[model samples]
Target: MMIKKLFALFLMLLWPSLSMAQTETITHGSLAIDRAVMRAALPGSKVTAAYMTITNNGAEADRLIGVEFSGAKKSEIHSMEMDGGVMKMRPVTGGLEIKPGESVTLEQGGLHLMFMGLTERPADGETRTLTLIFQKSGSLTITLPVKMMMGGHKTSS
Candidate 1:
């Protein structure tokens, strides 16, 4: 058992390239966003939902501090929790913690970005630009293609 553990450690240390290799092409570490989407709400509504995945490839954990986007008055991180038989959605205080070499997916029915007071509805087949701010990585902007729903999405590594 000890020998097997040593072999694993050797691989992780000797082949740092292997540890960095992932299914997705990561351009930078500390902050990243993927599969971001904005769903259209009812007309004259003040809220819309956004979903995505975040990854941190560094050796230390990172924090997602905030998010910003066009056509919205405000954006915040929110999550759903089950209380008894009722499922309630609430703001995610203190941001999100992303562990080293780990990925966290924010999707529908789970954690998502709340776009409030949209200045205009996001039409289909259009892309939305979202700027993600991290405590360590600063800010990153990624253009997310709007999809009908969260389906067929996969996380790299």
Candidate 2:
């Protein structure tokens, strides 16, 4: 009798979940930050760099408007371009464009975020919270892990 009672209780608990249908979540577009960190900058330096990858899984295109960080006085989008056989980095005033079903990679020698007037250097094994504001997706909060000066994976505070 006890066994039957337990089985009945289990069935009752499972009924609700089985009856409820699951629906797929449709994200018009999404961005994933692979890894972001700040390089060692001189004291009172006016510039630093951040690298990451922006991915769009949805069917529509998206735009990354700006980024905000606590340790930096100013954050701007920048890209590296070839000028007269020389690599020159410049600020992208219009922001970075992400096409539909595509991913824009911001690696070390290409596109990156320019962090100016860093209030303090992000030490190794520390985590920094950065907010990325998008043209349509509003804002996304990401915790970037601080690595060693030599680069590679460390840990986020």
Candidate 3:
């Protein structure tokens, strides 16, 4: 038993890349989060937005219940809409429901996660880990890479 434990530890150290890849791709049950990203807020900005594509591969629906990350006092799922001629934003009280075999995209100008009271802006090339909890899929954690938001940039990653 001791030799088995040592062998396991040796394998982990021998293949560090495998561990990193596993951390980046988080899968819980039948749900998957793809292309998760958070933009660096402008200087002195206290809030920032994060976007991702959530796919429900299971036979039943799932709800995204919560979000968490470092350097954030609070995080909530929000939806942006144009009410009349003005834009409005609101938090999703219950959760965001994802139907089976459907994909919900949280991107700019739409549904996204708002990180409030950030300690510092996410710098370019910086990586942060985000934990997303679901009603049925449990917790899905991924490494969120900070990138510059572009006018024409697409969220196809």
Output the number of the TM-score-best candidate.
3
Give a tens-digit lDDT track for model 1, residues 36-151.
66775555666677787888878999888799988889898888878899767788899889999898888877888888778877766777888887888888877666655533
TM-score of each: 0.73, 0.70, 0.79
Better of 1 and 3 by lDDT: 3
TM-score of 1: 0.73
lDDT of 2 at 22: 33
Clashes of 1: 0
Ranked by lDDT, top first = 3, 1, 2
Q: For candidate 1, list the clashing residue pairs, or say none.
A: none
What lDDT would candidate 2 get against the real structure? Answer: 0.69
Q: Is candidate 2 or candidate 3 better by TM-score?
A: 3
The sequence of per-residue lDDT tens digits that candidate 3 reaches over residues 1-157 is: 9999999999977675575477554456788777788987767778788899888989999999899878789889999888999767889989999999999999888899988888877877898888898998788777889887864222221
lDDT winner between 1 and 2, please give it: 1
TM-score of 2: 0.70
Question: Which candidate, 1 or 3, would have the higher TM-score against the true structure?
Answer: 3
Clashes of each: 0, 1, 0
Superposition error at 19 for model 2 (Å): 26
TM-score-wise, the better of 1 and 2 is: 1
**lDDT of every model, 2 decimals:** 0.72, 0.69, 0.81
